[model samples]
Target: MPALEHVQPLEHRSGRTNVPGAHGFLGRLRRRRAQREHEASVICFANALRGMFRDACAGIGLCQYVSVAAGITVRTPRVAEVRLGPPTSFTVELMAGQEPADFTSKDRGPRLAHTLGAHGLRVEPVAGRWVRIHLLDADPLRDGFGLPSLAVATGAESVILGRTEDATTLGHAIADPAHLGVQGQNGSGKSAFCYGLLAQLAAAPDVLVTGSDITGLLLGRAWDGTAHRAHQVVGTQDIAAHAVLLEDLVAEMDRRLETIPPRRDTIRPSPATPIVLVVLEEFPGLLRAADALPKPKRGEGIPVGDRIRTAVLRLLSEGRKAAFRVLMLAQRFEATAVGGGYARDQFALRLSFRVPADSLEMLHGADARPLGQEHANAAPGVAYLSGLGRDCERIRVPYLGEYGEYVDRVQRFGRRAES
Candidate 1:
């Protein structure tokens, strides 16, 4: 009747239906099988990852995390990446009686990525989207808890550094003259951390502090000899002095190391602990100087540059045991700004404050994309840390004004002086 339908011509040799029931069923079966295969692959990869991780834990005293490079392959919906897709708690469960436990599910991924990258495989592909990361080598330093380490208060003794929510120092005391590292972009809390450190250390008994900032003005007020005698020289020094300063610091580090105290429990507060802390504001200054001249020309006429380089190398190689900690302060902590590789690696501890989207890598480690996701535009005094522990953590430092006042009153004169 609808000859009208003008079903014109079913132009097909085989009269075909728009929805082929049999073909659709066959396609569905194929998809289901593919999915099953993908799932199986993921399980196999995950197990492989678990085994690799166990091996890493055994080799390295510390626990480690593995990231499967899922992008290398395709994964079915049934297979999910066993990673912190968001800012999540990361943890790793270790094998039985491993002495040190492995990463629990509560640790974050970026931190895991940094630690593993140092001694593990990267961008490994698994079945579909899965990957099995094999982390090798281990850290020798054990945390106070004998597991994953915590960020202890890196402040001079008696300075009253506040504890972050994730870490509590109710009874814990930091080493005096704590080497501090502050990193952030322009307007980040680099200056703030510097100010806080100076003031806090000043409060400690008989503590001496000094620092230099190339791109800041706040240090002028807090460290101005005319106003504050905290011993900070503000404004950029001529390249000559800048070069010599590093050499002097190296000498200082050597001297300090010679003074390291034996691990003692006298509870009498050993005087061997250094009370002076030096903060280098804007660490790029040294890196820039070093890279400008070739090794031969570095100290050719002036020995200053060569000496500085040697000093830094020695400090990095031996400062930790000597107790001569260096505090590197910068607006950002990128490999380039910090002189990359050797120079950048010298500073083991790095603290990034509020920074721009592109600079998280400087503050954290190279694999900071995940941290960028969470703290791209975070406020000053807030930062994410890795290498400091088994997982990356977001931290908020307390703000401090009147650094000199804090030093004079709370630190030196006691709380009564503040009133």
Candidate 2:
């Protein structure tokens, strides 16, 4: 008999096929390699940013040392997020220790940007002893993005204007009824900003939108036939009509004031008594037009210009409690243009778009004077907003799409007046 062929089992006794453990081992190796590479890349980037920040602090005379604690996070290709160790003082010889506030001074912002090879930087203090820094290698607002969906609900007291440099939504409290002063040059995206704001105001059931535009350029088609259109927008070259409109608003404010309970400080808006937003477009032109009008006969009460100025001043001074708000737009907010410094001071919210240094200072004060040229050259819709208990911030107003789209949005969200 031939030797029996060595018989081999069809399956391995271990009940395992292929290369046991090879696949899992290889997978583990690959994961370990990938994690190492990622960590190495993070270290490399962190080191690079550390060097940039080191040099920047030195140039700015900040004796405080900064450390990258949270590592590097890339928000966009051009933007990076990092957390820095709280500024701590260093002493050399007999030098006194400096405070962290010295390192975070507003005056040092531009200098810090220059030293960091960055277009812009936001230094925000976070919890504990860390400062969050958003480093921008390029302007995030150089190009316009579509407006974010409105987060405010119908009858909400706030309105979303646009976004800040860090892409945070910027909103204003309309319920509190503070006046807004908007200053920008021609073709500076002011009209677009106004349209974006008006769309939201019109959507709110407890807010009534009324506007006066001497050039008729801003207050036209979008508001013409909507029930959301309250108080028939003044959209013509008639200065007399503008004055009358403002006077009527003052009268309405007075009526609302009387309805407030003695103990309550303000009138809470309801469908029956909504907050009235008076938008004055080409505000300076309105004043100039009024000035150009012939004086009334000796017995005619007050000149149209005086009536306009007085009504505006009264509204600015007394409208907040009565739920009356003003949004005044002008090329320049000179004392003469807005009825003097006293009147200008009443604007609780001030926004300056692309304008000259003098105009920026006029709107935001001397600190803004240094940024005039920067403002003048800013991209359309870029502006500096200050007031409402917040420090001045650079923001890009929302782009509500093309003219037709904007009008459509205005009409679609418009809340009809209650019957």
Candidate 3:
């Protein structure tokens, strides 16, 4: 990989790097200033944490007598460096057998943050008894870092979706045909995330993104490819037409599956045989449309509305091995919205953003409930990543700086399918 621009060059500062390359004396001065400030923040944060523990530890029944040195271990890097995403944080290693949930209990995050005299500090567990505390000084999710150019991501195997929050971390979703769901309320950056993910997928040579939306608010300009080459876009203009489109997409997916060599483990997308990612936007719109249909008659086939939903559920279940996947976006997610009591369970990955805590029910094994009105309602893109057998992670979608340009760029790369 190419060297990151944020990397401090050695030709300049002998002592340390301050931004990129301020030479010699000036670089050192800037470096020292940054280092001093970082060190001071670390000191203040540690002191405040220690004080908080003094009062809460004994009350919480923690084993104060368990180890030779029983206080929390503050593990923060001494190298004061600037990072591009979320603010860097420190971890507090508790005594053996003491897990993170012990101290990171509900409401304790705000309390500890207040004690340290900061807001927007994200506190969560990293491992057994190790609590990672992100002491954020600013809102990292407010803007975008430059995204991967179309040339860079096009034809590559996987797609970059977003970064994990406090999770100043980068994460990718493999096109090895993955099914992903995102649930969040308005102002939760839902549309922003779809664009970010779609832009990269659009760049990929082997991937084509087709989506359906009601308001067209999210997929508006982006899905407008040339008629001959445009990946289909399903509009809410006609509900019945939309339902039929869902069935058509499912049939298309089935054809892809049939072409896969039997017993093969996975289907890989390539330019010649591109894989399809069918995105369902503002999914509730589809649900409402589907739900409007009358129930099926006793001896007949599935109801028209029922078929649309069942098609989605089946697509998610059977499409993975066929190099086909679905990205479902919703303002609300729960059993009722998802077709059946067990249908929601089929989604391979689920992300929940700022909403009433109850919305977390959509994500299985979800522990961190949305902190409503907490931390000023968590940043717009801030959310939690959940899946079966995985620890939940807080994540944020990167901004797609220029929406129109991104759409145009995708159009340049994506063509209508022959399949």
Candidate 4:
């Protein structure tokens, strides 16, 4: 038998030898084949997504007869572009001339998501007649995320609430001084959200954090002996102390407003006069407790509840210029519960988490009624945020870990309070 001649490896122009499984001719061919397969698979997925979207629109009663304007384009693997068409006979009769608005409304978001059986969806109106449907492949907010370590030198002027559906951090601008309203049912992670927010605020040297908890659970252990703790954190049984806290806030607000220069519309916070964040947990219960207190026997006197309500309203209406921000947490934000519709409107930042229809509407207006039903079973810490110059969008509040870790973070980030 003739001995097999030894074959020298062929070297490609790029100096790579034709070794098996290396980036040579065979490897390039394999990569091209895989690329083609991936492209084909993506095309198939796009077609399927388009079909599902069309069927979803039909199921939601959005139809147009023989119109070129009605079509869905694949924007990405997870998003679809939809063009709005004139309403069909049924839609025209049902929505009259407002069918387009109804089609692109935020309220329709949940229904469209359900119809498509998507993980989560947000409908964003693109110029005239176009809307983008963002489909979440996996819920980014399903598992709570931890707070990012912020630079202490930067000084957190805004509190980082959580992450948005787009995986961007959602922050509430406290530096500009807008009152915030947070409402949710019990066990809705409302307290967790509060803790996260308070932790950030307490860490800011230019912020003075004071809070009252009707349950006495929120403000006690985590804040008691921390250097971040500023003013007294009133507890549940102290209805009179609640009144006193509000009154003191109002007095401070008045003092700041009086001292503001005529040329300036708002006060800038500093170590000398830090922004006052008055957090009232279970605010409605506090109001009720104040109302239950007996009237002064000396003469005609305002009930403690009325006094607290008046003080809160004054703060909401006039606090912005004075650098006093209120964060009111409650199960409901009805006009009566929050003093009135005017008071509710003053909260430029509103967050509703797993609340009832009435409560959602109270926070986001009547348009949010449909969303309330859609989010009736939203996960804890999931909430709708409104009044930041954008349509209300869903968000997930940051989880601060266990109680021990939360308290430790609070202490770690907290600055010593100025005398």
Clash pairs detected, candidate 4: none
What is the descending TM-score order? 2, 4, 3, 1
For residues 143-210, write the lDDT of model 4, one tens digit per residue: 88887655133223566877887788877657765788998888888888877877766666677777
**Compared with the true structure, what per-residue lDDT tens digits does model 3 show for residues 1-419?**
12323556564456654545576566667667777897788677666655654554444455454334776744321222222234546566666665555544444544555554545566566665566666666554655555555433443444555665343555555564457888888878777777767766665556666656776645546555433235554566666666676778788777777777777766667766566677888777688876776777898876666777877777778877767677888877777776665666767788877766667644634345434345236667777676534566566666666667667655765454445
CA lDDT, every model vs. true structure:
0.47, 0.72, 0.62, 0.70
Against the true structure, candidate 2 reaches a TM-score of 0.77
Estimate TM-scores for all models: 0.50, 0.77, 0.69, 0.75
Between candidates 1 and 4, the lDDT winner:
4
The digit string of per-residue lDDT tens for model 2 on 1-419 reads: 11212323223345555744434556456546766897787667666766666666666766433455776422211123433322211111211453334443557767777676666665555444444555566776887867754634544556777687768887776886578999888988888888888877767767787757776645656775666455744544566888888899999989888888888999888867877888889888888888898998899778999999999899989998888888899888999998888989999899988898888887788777657777789888999999868778788888877888677776677766556
User: Which structure is stronger by TM-score: 2 or 3?
Assistant: 2
Q: What is the C-alpha RMSD of each candidate to the true structure, in Å?
A: 16.1, 10.6, 9.7, 8.9
Off by over 4 Å in 2: 1-55, 64-104, 124-134, 148-152, 228-230, 417-419
TM value for model 3: 0.69
Scored by Cα lDDT, where does model 1 land? 0.47
Off by over 4 Å in 4: 1-52, 58-63, 67-107, 122-138, 149-156, 225-230, 298-300
Q: What is the lDDT of residue 238 in candidate 1?
A: 50
**Predicted structure 3: lDDT:** 0.62
Residue runs of model 1 more than 4 Å from their true location after superposition? 1-179, 215-221, 224-232, 256-276, 286-307, 356-358, 361-368, 387-390, 402-419
**What total of clashing residue pairs does each candidate reach?**
24, 0, 6, 0
Question: Which candidate has the highest lDDT of all?
Answer: 2
Query: Which wins on lDDT, candidate 2 or candidate 4?
Result: 2
